[model samples]
Target: MPVAGALTPIDWVTRFDELSARRDRLGAVELDELGLAAWFLGRAAESERAWDDAHRAYLAASDPDAAIRCAFWLGYTLGERGEAVRARAWMSRLFELCGSEPDARAGAIAMLCRSVGAFATGRLDDAAEFAERAVALARASGDTDTEVLATMNRGRALVFGGRSEEGFAYMDRVMLAISSGTVSDRVAGPAYCAVVASCLDRWDVERARVWTRDLSAWCDAQRGLEPFRGECSVHRATVLRLGGEWGEAETTLVDVCSRERRPETLENALYWLGDLHRLAGRTADAEAAYRRAAELGREVQPGLALLRRDAGRLGAARTGVARALGATPLTGVRADLLAAQVELEVDHGDLGVARRAADELRALADTIDTVYLAAQADRAAALVAIATDAPEQALTLLRRSWGAWRRLDAPYEAAITRMHLGRACRTLGDEEAAQLEFDAARTVLTTLGAIPDLARLERLAAGPDRTPAAGGLTRREVEVLRLIASGRSNRDIAHELFLSEHTVARHVSNILAKLALPNRASATAFAFEHGLTQPA
Candidate 1:
């Protein structure tokens, strides 16, 4: 067998496989090295087998401390693979071993493992308590690996418990230590991933961007760092997607999915691939990718609903998003679902549902205090206001939404908000302001190569120019006239169009004055004469 120090992780895996085939006996140390090689190669089953062998070997050799270490690694790998019950069982064995041996390092590792299991099961208080004990024990034993793991768990618990700022601050300190090389390579990668996950969970994109940079640098410094490199690539790809570099992001995600062996990493990359394809108007490709992601046990949500909306299946989109929102509680993903619900409900002309969704989104944003969620809430509110003929209120909300999106450096969303702002301004008779907003939005959409959005915006901007010259009636007035000609009352028109009855009345009076008609019957005759009424 090759000496562990003489071979790289990949080389060791090959050598170990050869040795296994030859039926060569491995010492406890060699078995542990084999496990490490399997882990670095992303072969979880192989890693677990090697670790189990090493644990048995160490116990037979009367090395309780070595056995405990093996148990900890086995537990960590199982937990990462989402086998929580198996992971907890291994951790319990570690605890029992530590009890007999009374070693501080073993006790700390046991506590950290238990804490992780507790956190996974949603016992945040128990997680925090166990993590604290682990940190204390690790510090006393001078075990930096255990200390870092315990600290990360504690920070995660705090973040999930609603102390985001404090949790992030603590995690930042840990990241700083990793960046400074104070933490070992064994712990650095996991720490970086944990912090990135926490930032993503909280919708702290700016922080995620910063840490992704650091993670990329760290990965570059280590040659052939298999599993961590795949994870770092995932994080960088997410940041790229958020920065509007869709092509690059898609390439990166595809590469990661091709190279990564872990189901979780592959699942996330596939989901992101679907998002990029959907955003680029490739519906078939997006659907295929979403299906693959779902097969990997990922939830295909907001993206799938938005894709259906883009395909003009608004009813299916509404049903899908509404079902998702109804089943999910208020959380980060719920925020995204609610945003999709608002747009779908509004487009379906269910203004009451849209208004309720907006209100709920606003309340959730206020409770979470995330800039992204707040911006989404503002956008939803603006759409509801515009539908209700409250142009002034819509304008205020759109501006707030636009500012937030701009500050978040999300150009596409900012451009969408600007388009809405333009419509609000036009409704309020501010033609110059409306034109400027439209121009700005057009530039962004063009630069981003957002073909569908640009096409939609062009159609909206052309509506006024297409107005019939008989009496200079607006598009909305024409719509109201058509509904009048259909033998619909004002209340019926308001209900169908998602407008207030008062707004419908005002549109009727405007239609009468513009067409120089005396009443609804005359306006109906004019509409039919102008060929504005639908054919039987």
Candidate 2:
């Protein structure tokens, strides 16, 4: 038996079982409780029905305020469930009930709904304005739920609009309210999840890690809280992965992937699972997971590209990452895509494109001001420096990046940085320093089973001359293959490589023949499949 207002959805659901037989006797208040309990328990259809019933009950009882509340939840939840038309109908009903100029509480909820709609459609300014108005109205009406939720919405809008520090301050206030029990369980649950999600979207891993733990605890304490549990697990798995707890992250993701019914939640879990598998060099498993996530409408970008790269499909990796970056508009998401672009371009020996990408990533990192994004930017810049004969610059950047990764407790990323540090040191003629970095990186990669990276490190140590060409292609043939994969014609290749068109055509023919590819397209595919973007 929980206290009156501290929600225990399981207890209410049990009570619902006994009273459902006599549901006709239940009034608006009782029906409202049942609706909330049903929603928290993941019974969406039942929850909607009960909320509808409660709305009608409130109407019959001549309580327009209460009815408006029910309609708001119905509209919001319906929108979330992808029933946009039905959601609009409910919102229409709410507005009709409001009758042009409603009282403070009802108007606050209406404003909150508007804010949600605006945020969903990428109207950040409108969303923030509506949320601010909602907060003001809710505070005036003494509606803590509306005020807290509106504050969260405003924070998200601010963050997405690239005002990261201000947005986080607002979100921090909301969390403080939740921690102090100034908000109800219903409001607190979503607020906790939303703020943590915003932190993740901005690459504020430390903040997200902290809030996710708190959210998990909140869900656990609620016993039968179901709607938020899946999202909580997804956030937790992300934190685990970032902290280098890959095994635990995999377990959590696999469990959520199997059990979560929500498409978005399940998609995230599967994507993260793919990322984990990719790091471990389980290419087949990673591909399957990424494919499933894509089927669920997830844009599996940087992870998929990195997977292709690890599998030695450098041409395909670069093309995929470039496409993803072009389509993505969100700054935080673009930071990730740009980082991948930098890595791919560097590997393809396109130093100019890589440098531009690194510059963009550094700009984004400065704007976001998060340690994670900062480290990513540093690592990207270091890669470009390493490729362009700037070992001193690369070493400086790598040191900062390695320290950041260490502070973040991300062992795999730190190890990768160490490998790059070794390259920079060796380039600077510090053989002793290079050896130490290589040894440390090798040990960590071996412990983590990072097979692809370990193999790359071994090849690096063995020197460029020792590396073998893919598909028996000669160095010049591989170079021609790379140009072909980039959509370059024989004329372009001839112009770029200072050869006759006939000579370029001959090289292309040799490339296709060596790789057993039927035509230029197949040749391109082979180039991608075997990572023959550049000669060894």
Candidate 3:
């Protein structure tokens, strides 16, 4: 074939296929290359077959070291595909071969496998120990591939064990090695994915954004490569979304969702699609994306609940979010769910439940200590404080959250936090401060095209009591206008407001006159149009 790294994966695959068709039997090294080529082209079955054949050939030729490498790859690929039993069998075979050879490279691979197992089973201490042993063995053997993999594993374990700084340090070094070409091609793909995934899991958006760019470039260099391409697209889309490039983010997510074969990667793309659609106020599209992700066994939460709330289905939103928080354990975006729960409960006027969720979120933020989590925790606490009439406390938290969101370059979140700040300022009678905050938030939301948030801000700025009294109509007249929109007659309004029929009739006339409406029907339409009423 071509010399190593001279041809793209596509070119390598074409040459390998031509040779395989012409030859009676390909050599073990050829088969190994074919396996990697097939994997890069998303041909999982072909890759497995080639690797298995190569493993058998290596054994037949008494090359146990090469055979052990093949076995490690087979186990790794199978485990990634969720074929746990088959993966375990291969790993077991790898260990058995290592027992006979007793070499440092083989020992390193075996230790890495053990670390993976322990981590999967939640034995963080054991996982960390095994990963360190693997690292030591790989270093002794001068196996850069095993060293990178083992270091990434140790870092991941440390992150999971609540030592995020140490874990990321290890992961960062591994990434540097990968960037410097110390890592082999086979190890490079997995290494890039591992470090980026860890960065995203911790909500280190800045790190994720930078690494995702590197990953995209790396993927682009290897034409026909599919294993890590989906993840790269998903991560790039996230960075784009956070940076307010909604159109491009949507395009990337849609492309990945349509093409990605891996269920987990596709699920992530779909979930992000839902969130982007929801923020853009495309309710039906968001629901469809979320439903598809849920079908693929993704926990499409917080975003789905927020969608319900945006549609004015507050009860459904509260119920769904509460159920999600109750069912989900404290891991893997649980902090996001808790933050949503706190906000939903606050909006539903359940201050006690909101406070509990806020407390949990605060604790999670303290433990995670990431910018995103900290911002979410502060905002959730601010919402609870606002509901409980602790305006000063809410203001303090909102400023912190606002600064964090601004630092993260998340215009949408920053604007939303400013809206909270406005509310707190209004509650404390700082009218000028409140007005400035509201005006700033409105400008950002208007620019972002965040329809629901923009609408809410409009209502907040409508009147002193957050009542929408347009066209110079008094608050009492606005109330009458809303009732009229609900199809309430003058007599019904009179009874509800404990006023005389003449007084209620007078208020209705004044509302129509102030709004320059010809009749009650026009008045009703005007009320709904101006945020004084909503559809049932």
Candidate 4:
């Protein structure tokens, strides 16, 4: 009963059922319609079967071009479903069918499929080469849809191949095409998702924000567009979370998960929801979200490790992060894991482990040449310096990190580095500068509603200044006193502050004598009572 040219998925389903009841043989078009309906419904096996049948029907009709198109979609869907071997086999069949004398449009489609295969296998250079060829061939054949896809593919390949500027340039062009309505509706959704993903992967937050806004506007203007809406919503939520809008981010991701029909989209939304919950200190909720994400086949990493660290399971946290770092190759995600490793190792007082992680982060930053990674590396190094009692060196590193974060417009990260800088300044006996930094950081953290960071800052800022000078002791004696109160031995204190053990002993004696304390324990108690042992 459906019109020939206006069949919805429901109409197609109804038609297919009626045809089956009448024992009618379905042709290429019918099979293709069924496949599309099954795909839209997230029925992967059924969709694959329908598409395979459509491909054979097209071949039987001697429509090699239509069959090749079906092959491309089948291969693409298979790849997305993680059936890489079958995907490659379908792509290989397409290549064989096309042979050497294919038309320009067929050649372009074949190259596009090859590019996807190369990208899947991590041969970025080959992918770029194939995508470029596709673009040229499609343009010559006036195939705008293929050209658009090829352009996006080429951009991603170039980005992964370390030509990010050029890659983003191509991506920007594709975005222009999409905005101008030059791209086909079929290509627009995937193109937008690809560009946004590339921007996020490269730590190009500003670009991601711009593209996400554009995508939101585009989605708003369209009615009933489903394929990319969930992905766009996720990207929008990520931008919100990064901008310190945690409540809105939580709401957005929850909405996305509720409406997402695809397993991949639902999994991604749930993972981000877990991240938001964890950040807001909703431990049980975070665990539930993470569990659901895991059930959907998402690997909950660095976030899970951080949750363990927060729960006082330092050993488990250490093992989880170490395993994650070992398994992950060098990439943006690896940089994030390394950053967490540095923080965890520093807290565990494993300065050597922290230093190694920091070194690797610095190397990764240099390789990627991204400002965000550079800032993270500097912050990690600064934390290690602080843990090792090199406050002056820590101050320098923290300043660099603060500046980098500021340049990137990352307010939360900038504020964190400022707080560390304040501590470093306090350690160096510059109370005036320390107070200024603390006040500034407090304002930012409060505005962002970063509860844990604010709480830590409150703890650090609680104690009144009780320097050795005020207690009839020198600054060096005050430094030694605090370390002693922290349970460091004389040798440990000496090593930490880069002092000789004899000098440290002399400082200890001076502190004991001045305070009229009989022993180190009493001195430590005095330090605590006077608040000298509070974090600098």
Give Cα-based local distance difference scores for all models: 0.80, 0.84, 0.84, 0.80
TM-score of the candidate numbered 3? Answer: 0.84
lDDT of model 2, residue 209: 83
In candidate 3, which residue pairs get closer than 3 Å at backbone N, Cα or C atoms, i.e. clash? none
After superposing candidate 3 on the true structure, give the runs of residues whose Cα lies further than 4 Å from its correct spot: 1-12, 15-19, 329-332, 464-536
- Tell me the tens digit of each residue's lDDT in model 2 across 449-471: 88888988887655442225455
* Tens-digit lDDT track of model 1 for 120-175: 88999899899999999999999877798789899899888887777777788777
lDDT of 3 by residue, 1-536 (tens): 22212223345457557656854578888888888888877888988999999999899999988899999999999999999999999999999999965889889999999999999899999999999999999999998888989999999999989988899889888878877766667787788888888887778887788788877877877767788888889988988998888989999999998888899999999999999889988889999999999999888888998998888899888888777777764454788888888888886658788889889888877886789889999999999887755678899999999999999999988999999899887656566798899999999888888988888888877654434346655455667778899999989988887667876776776666656789999998887778888522
Predictions: Cα RMSD each: 5.2, 10.0, 8.9, 6.6
TM-score, per-candidate, Cα-based: 0.83, 0.84, 0.84, 0.79
Candidate 1 minimal-lDDT segment of 10 residues? 1-10
Which 10 consecutive residues of model 4 have the lowest summed lDDT?
Answer: 1-10
Write one digit per residue (lDDT tens) for candidate 4, span 428-512.
Answer: 5566787799999999988877666777677666434354434855455678889989999989988888876876776787678
Instruction: Give candidate 4's TM-score.
Output: 0.79
- Global local distance difference test of model 1: 0.80
| Model 2, residue pairs in steric clash | none
- For candidate 2, the 10 contiguous residues with the lowest summed lDDT are 1-10
